[model samples]
Target: MMTTALSPEHSGDETPKVKDYSPTSYITHSNFEFCGYSLKIARTLSASLGVSAYVWEAGIALCRYFEKEKISFAGKKVIELGSGTGIVGILAALLGGNVTITDKPTILEQIKNNVSTNIPPACRHRLKVRPLTWGQDHTNFPTDYDFILGSDIVYSLVSQPSLIETLRHLSNQGATIYLSSEFRTGNGSLPFHEVLLPDYFNCQVVDRLMGKDITVYKMTKISTDPADGL
Candidate 1:
């Protein structure tokens, strides 16, 4: 429960930019404890698979937010996009949600390993890892999710469009969406705002206590058309 303001000079990015590492071999560990539940998870700390394998500050901020708000995930269907290291999704499953943590195909096994390693046997059935390439159609993925979670996903402008589209496709009507990102970055939040505007999602900045200047956005899909039934 520390409120460290993030600066560009010291963003606390744990994963060093390595030229290359075998995705199957280079492993790193991340641990979390929330609401009387504790977990230790691991990931392949290499960017070789087009995925990050370390815990980001934005993600830690999210875990803190959930802890502070006492957000309950019991019986809720949730999907976490860009679930790097799968910490947040694992936490949700621990809170009683049927959660799916997703990333690119290359890093799925690592994510699965993290889930298998962290989730308890009783809750293991609720946590799953799926391969998801942002900006692509997710018709094959689960829909009607009650909540959608993403952390530090807005850094890349090129991927924002596809990310927005995928969110639109997967989100159920009136679903609550939470997105967290670092403050004072070059990307800021322009791309997310511009894309989400046409989609009619009511977005707000919820002030939460977190390390650095990580901004957590609370979004809810507004049903503008009555014909769009659940």
Candidate 2:
């Protein structure tokens, strides 16, 4: 079945866990040179199947968009839905956006642990974490956000509908959603989103060469509202 949101049960338990670590001792990617900063990929994705520990491509573009476009995340409310490893969401809060870094409760602890480790202390004052699953409806949210971000979130066809629906529901009027993805030749899951996105959004792809094995695409949400516009 096609879905666009996830139930809070996806977050697992409410056990609050937070720990700190040093990247110097961790086995992570050596360098991700983009957006004027070097992001580390850390590990090949162990969270789910087929997904590798590849660093976020379009995410790097979104970071560049923040810096080059002089995008102000400072004091703005932000959410990173389906944030895997949450590099971009952490970046948003670090840069001054009042950020909510959410994922399945399953990964929520990992998100917090990563936040403690990754956020450069200089900007750590502005970020927080939450449990959010797309496609599963809920009434909990800040009610409005100046920006909502997702990066490389598509991995299944069912997720596309949930993602689109979640984006529509969570977005405020005139709010902007910055999503990024790369075209995969025949992953069965790659092109799934391309067709579905146009239904609820005027999607645009921003392309650029990132590395030897990556091409990034950014999808901007042009217009939408809750209730699926359905």
Best by TM-score: 1
* Candidate 1 Cα errors over 4 Å, as ranges: 1-25, 188-191, 194-199, 209-211, 226-230
- Provide the lDDT at 106 for model 2: 64
Q: Report clash pairs, candidate 1.
A: 4-212, 5-212, 6-212, 6-213, 135-162
lDDT of 2 by residue, 1-230 (tens): 11111121121122222222353322233233333444432432344412323334555556665665556677788888877566778767667788888777666655665677677777666787778777775357755878888766765666777777777777766566777655555543355555666666666655443452223344445544467576
Q: Taking the tens digit of each residue's C-alpha lDDT, what string does model 1 give over 1-230?
A: 32332332222323333333563546544345666766665656444754366667788788778888899999999999988778789888988999989988877777787788778898888888888897664777866899999988887767777877788888877688998887545774655664654466878878544346668888887786868765
Candidate 1: lDDT of 19? 33
TM-score against truth, every candidate: 0.82, 0.68
The alpha-carbon deviation from the true structure for residue 221 of candidate 1, after best TM-score superposition, in angstroms, is: 1.1
Give candidate 1's error at residue 33 in angstroms: 1.9
TM-score, prediction 1: 0.82
| Worst 10 contiguous positions by lDDT, candidate 1 | 2-11
